[model samples]
Target: MPSGKGQGEPFKLEPFQKLFIRAVYEPQLKLRRVVRRAILSMARKNGKTALIAAIVLAHLVGPEAIVHGEIYSAANDRDQAAIVYKFARQMVDLDPELGQMIELVPSTKTMIARRTGSVYRAISAEAGTKHGYLPSLVIYDELAQAKNRDLYDVLDTSFGARDEPLFIVISTQSNDPEHIMSKLIDDGISGVDPAIVCHLYAADEECELGDEKQWHKANPALAKFRDYEDLATSIRKAIRMPAEEPKVRNLFLNQRVSPHASLISRAEWKACAGESKLQDGEEVYLSLDLSSTVDLTALMIGSVSDPCRIEPHFWKPRDKLIEHSSRDFGSGSHRYREWAEAGRLHDSPGKTINPEAVALFIAEMSQRYRIKGMAYDRWHMDYILREFDRIGLQAYEDCEKGGDGLRLVPWGQGYRDMGPAIDALELAVIERQLIHPNNPVLNWNMANAVATSDPAGNRKLDKDKARFRIDGAVALSMLLGLRARDRNIKPVDIEALIG
Candidate 1:
């Protein structure tokens, strides 16, 4: 079997592997084996399959063997399930003494320890019919990749009749937090069940992307068995391409981050954070995005200058704020209440965000800063227009018709209008030409936001397709769009306005 040091050699357990074995198998206080289940998680290339193979050998023909013992390696699919069986077959083939003792049946991917009368086989959720078999030992490979908990439940329940049944799950962390493997990892760490043992090797979410020291936390076999330079190259690529970062962090760093589908990486969004307080007298572009009664509403005001300073305003109804915040919409992805208490998110008074309150806030801001222009989705602003009129915020067709009247730019949410603006925002972020108040709500919106691109490589944010609420990001993009289109914005005179 292959290992980090070299391939085609007898698989040997490392120090960490031995420690994990001890924790899983060692008996304590009247129990023959303390742990009924063991979960081992780490970054890829840590020789998990090899370790799984070794465990199978230990239980099947080694000291733990029992007559008529049934050992199975389970995976999401047949190909994956066959991995451990292949490795075990190689081990038995290489050893002359073991070759005399074990019978191999390649047709069904099964092995029989001749002396002990133990049976081992590879099974998958796809092969069909997983019921009626009592398993002595089950090693589940990459449980994170499983579509649902059906196979896991079957394997878990199958162990009931055995004397010392062991269920071992070995895999890298899944990108999704809601996966069964994720729950097992969490429960293992929480120490909820004394019978469940967990050995997780993963870097923290805040660990720097390029830190080799931090990389070792997730990759226990780094440099020893795994190639160090190969990992370094991957990290460099992740840093250069922000879109690949989520996968890199999830796969290599063993972090529970979203995969490649994320429109913006966490690192890219974080680099743009700052105290982006728009100067009191600066001419800033204003944009709005309205959400459903159950969702968020956003107002973004920002300077068009370099290092684009932005102050984002978010509102949710007071009644549903706590309830929405508590739900794991993305499975602990959002912390709306925490952000609200920190003075970042504003709470609307009633069950829904009132358009009058939004318009009045705009009118109040116009008192201090000159409303250079306002951009909004044309389809949803009809009701808000009456609120604008009631609050004395007059709308002008263009800057030419605007004499102290707000130039209302009707922005469409289609690719034709939004594609170029999205490009500008992406470029600004990459170039470090944008700054924000380090608002968590805004950051969360951007993190949750995903984009749909055209054949021409023009990409626009799709709120419908996003994993979570993206109101702030949509508003910010519209603000950037207005900032790009209009440049004749006049700065405000604060003292004169007050006088």
Candidate 2:
């Protein structure tokens, strides 16, 4: 049924598909095209496999063929890997000309063109340690589902000897924005590299779930590829089952939402973003989130002024920056590299954040800015306090600076304390009162943040099910919480939010 083998309707390229092909294959002043990679991403049931089959056929024996060229269609598993192969095989069988030239070997999930001696094989991530294959073109299907990037790295590197190698990735999005596919999609969408061609067809995240008008954004083949009545049935079922909403959004709308939701929406956080930053001699309140040695450690500095201007000092081990971004788990594929290049992220020496460096940095900030002392979690305050002593900067335990020394106030991480902090940040965002340098790291943390609440409706930042590091946002909120508390500005009514 997936192959549509007996369907009388001929396989033809849609306008969208044709445009993608032209962008990928069309040459410029030179004979070879500029693009080395093409990413075609959309929702399911979009005739992706059929379009892929056509491209495979063209390269195997038709217009794009070359002698002994090796082509591979890869997926996360064998079953998915064989899809394009099966489609191409059935198409070959339908035409006498193709049947005469192409040899189908179902057992191996391979097709060979007799005329050109070119070979196409279906491979998957399970087939690890693939080596010594000179690939002219590698088609990765649903690459976002891969458990790791090993298979992709191998196949990509194998194209080293080819003159004009092309790597084609066709898939939906990954819920984790750090996945390799997600990174590629972001880069492609950003147009960071002109050598990469990307075509994405997906509905907006805020689009009405069952709205038929918005369906075409994600499904270019809505009517021609599948019966509209059947799609409507699926939509109706999903609407009735609230639990099925995530599935519908992920699979049908092609959104990046996972099982857990973000604490603050991107639009909400972006709304409060400003170019405002810390000023010399400006009164500053600080929050220090000292994470583990290998994790991110953040410091948020903000003024108590009406339009609360803020800045951050975020540090990670210089050595682990790239490794952190490329990991399969925990905030993989973040734009750490880009942020680092832009001087937005600070790199500490070696493989761990130096507490002495952090303490020294704090002392330095005190010289330029008047202090309201720094709020800190007790989790790793000893390390920082010890560093302060080593640098001859006395870290006082009071809220305001005492005897020209640094003030370190305790900020608990539990709901009892963080509940107000969370409320304060939310209120500031709603009122457009907080301003920051629009730091990418802070923005990312805010987007990944999620909140958990107690029976009394007291809430705290939930890192357990959160997308990734939320230290910066937590710290930002703590400073805002302190501002409201110290200034006796009436706190956000927790009962109102709870009620």
lDDT of 1 by residue, 1-499 (tens): 6433667776777888998999988756575777899999999888888888888888888988999999988888987877777877888887888889889999999999898889999989888645887999999998877765667777888877788889999999976554578879989989888899999999887787988888999999888787799889999999999878888898899987776465656667778888788777787789989887657999999886777899999988877776786453422223566667789888888888888888888888887787778888775677788988777787776635525577788888889878766766776677687898778678768877788978966678886777667888888888887786665333333225335
Q: Residue-wise lDDT of candidate 2 within 90-139, one digit each (tens)?
A: 78877889899988889999899898899999888777746887999888
Candidate 2 residues lying further than 4 Å off, grouped into runs, are: 1-9, 129-131, 190-195, 227-247, 271-274, 318-344, 399-404, 436-440, 491-499
lDDT of each: 0.80, 0.81
Worst 10 residues of 2 by lDDT: 328-337
RMSD to the true structure for each prediction, in A, is 9.7, 3.5
Worst 10 residues of 1 by lDDT: 489-498
Best by TM-score: 2
